[model samples]
Target: MRSGIVAIVGRPNVGKSSLLNALVGQKVSITAPKPQTTRHRIQGVLHGDNAQIVFVDTPGMHRAAKKALNKAMNDAASNSLHYVDLALFVIEAGRWTDEDEAVLERLKSVKSPVALVINKVDKFSDKNDLLPLMEKLAPLREWAFVMPLSALKGANVNVLAKQLMERMPEGPPLYPEGQVVGHDLSFTISEMVREKLMRSLAQELPYALTVETEAVEREGGLLKASAIIWVERDGQKKIVIGEDGAMLKRVGTAARRELEEMTGGKVFLKLWVRVKEGWTDDPKALSRFGYEGG
Candidate 1:
């Protein structure tokens, strides 16, 4: 059997997380329209008949500011390229940008074979346009394979998966058959809460919010979970809590329902919003939010 790790590297909103979900056949990472929605290196394991591919979904590589959090995120994305069997350099179909070039430059340092993945092919009108796009990108670097696929529509994804498996070195499976992700229950629960908040809140609020699963306990036939939502300011906290606590209630309800389905049992979730001024820029605060390696 073949087994190895494949790092999906790309610019923001290029559908790296979507590709991971499609390959794994489940949602192991949270995806949103906003750039930098993913803050950590999420590993999703795909178990095949004779091989297992562990996909590392990373934050979007972008031009970084001086903020510690931003630096840490860029570091996370770049670091994922090292120590991997293969790298899938994903780019949006029909277009190329400076940020995409930056991602390509970063991949140059990695010794692993890079596969040029042109995602979102379903957005193109005429299929013939892909040939010119591929020709334009081909000179940037030598690739193991150039594939055009739609992560959202799952077009050609299976073919890409088979090619990737064939390239991986022969070894035993790294993870059990039933396991899908590398993170624990608490991290998944916290991410679920953050996803709900990201979907419900305004554009500005999503970046300012972070969730922590404070406590999780088993109570008879149900699972009890307590979480805290950290905001950067008092006004942001109020916005998250909403007038008369309407917004927080909505987020909690949505999280609980998904948690119940994920855990296969009832979930009792408690959510609270707290203010932690300038958490994003502060190194200590960013670490508390799980942003490390700056």
Candidate 2:
């Protein structure tokens, strides 16, 4: 059997988390249209007949990590490269920004074989249009493998998976059969709730808040979960609660529905919005909210 760890590294909004979910055939990580929606290093495992691939989905690595939270995310992304069997350096089909270049520079120091994964190829009408971008990136490094695929639409995803499986070192399965995510149910619940908030709230407000699962219990075929939505100020808290609690209700409903679908059980979710006063910049608060390397 073959088993290995593949770290998926890229800039924000490049669909790293989406690709992980598609590969695992399950939603092990949360995603949003906004940048920095992923703030942790989440592992999604893919089990084949003779191989297991553990894909580490990391936060986008970018510059100007002024806040403690942002620095921690950058650190998480960079740290994931250590001791990895392979690294998938994912990028958009046609766009190469400064942050992408930054990530490339960082990858130069890693000993693992780095594969260039050109994601979101469906955005282009003609496949030939990708030639220029591919040619530009080809000379950057001796890439282990280069693939162009759409993570969202699953176009060419199978080919990418097959290529990755072949590169894994021969060994036993790293995780048990039928298991996908490495995180616990609480982490999943918190991420799902945060994803809803990220998609539902204003861009700035979503960055100012985080979700923490306080309690979880199962009773009579129902999974009951209590969580807190911590914000920075009273105004932000009021906005999250919304007029007559409409916003909070929407977030909770969406999260609960997704949770039930993911867990294959009914979910009783309770959410409360509270102020934590600049939690994003506070190291203690960042640790409390589960931001590693904070």
Candidate 3:
């Protein structure tokens, strides 16, 4: 059987997480419209008929990684390129930025074959409009394969999967048949809470906040989990908690519903927002929050 690792690299908000989810037919990474929604190197396994593809979903690589958190995220994405069977360089169709150029320059050093995945093609009404962009990028490098598809609309996604499957080296499955995600239960639970907070809070709030699952246990038929939402300042904490604790309650409810659906069991989740005061820039705090390269 064909089995290998494929790293998805791209600039922030280019739909890299969406592409990984579409390829795996499940949500292995949380996605948001905001940049840097993904903060870790998450893996999703695709168990096909004759191949098993371990797709690594990485944080968006970008410039000006001044903070400890951003540096760690950039490191996580860049580190995934090494020793992989294939690398999928994902980008949004009809748009290219300086960050994309930066990622391409970084990919030049990657020994693994890199495939150009032009995602979000469904944004355009006419397919022919993509030709100019394709022609422009064709000479940049000798890419292994180039496929234009939409991760959100599922357009040409299967074709991309088939192409990736063809390139995987022959071997046994990397993960068990039914296992789709690489993270553990606590990580998954923490991410769910973070995702809810990311989607609900203000734009800058997400960068200053993170979720940590403190305790998880089974009480009869229910799964009980308690987590702390760490913020960098007292003002941020108030915003997260909201007036009379409305915001926190809303986030907890949304996260608990998703957790229940994911685990296929009832979930009782407790969330408490605490002030950590610039945790994003503190190495010790970053390490405590599970960020690598801290």
Write candidate 1's Cα lDDT for 113-162 as tens digits: 99999999999989998888899888888899999999999999999999
Across 179-265, the per-residue lDDT of candidate 3 in tens digits comes to: 999999999999999999899998799999999999999998899999999998999999999999999999999999998998899
* Number of colliding residue pairs in model 1: 0
Native-vs-model 3 lDDT? Answer: 0.94
Q: Rank the candidates by lDDT, best first.
A: 3, 2, 1
| Candidate 2 residue pairs that clash | none
What are the clashing pairs of model 3?
none
Model 2, span 1-294: residue lDDT tens: 999999999999999999999999988999999999899999999998888999999999989798999999999999999989999999999999999999999999999999999999999999999999999999999999899999899998989899989989999898999989899999998999999999988769998988899999999899999999999999999999999999999999999999998878899999998899989999999998889866
Per-model CA lDDT versus the true structure: 0.90, 0.94, 0.94
Per-residue lDDT of 1 in model 2 = 97
Worst 10 residues of 1 by lDDT: 285-294
| Model 2 C-alpha lDDT versus the unseen true structure | 0.94
* TM value for model 3: 0.98
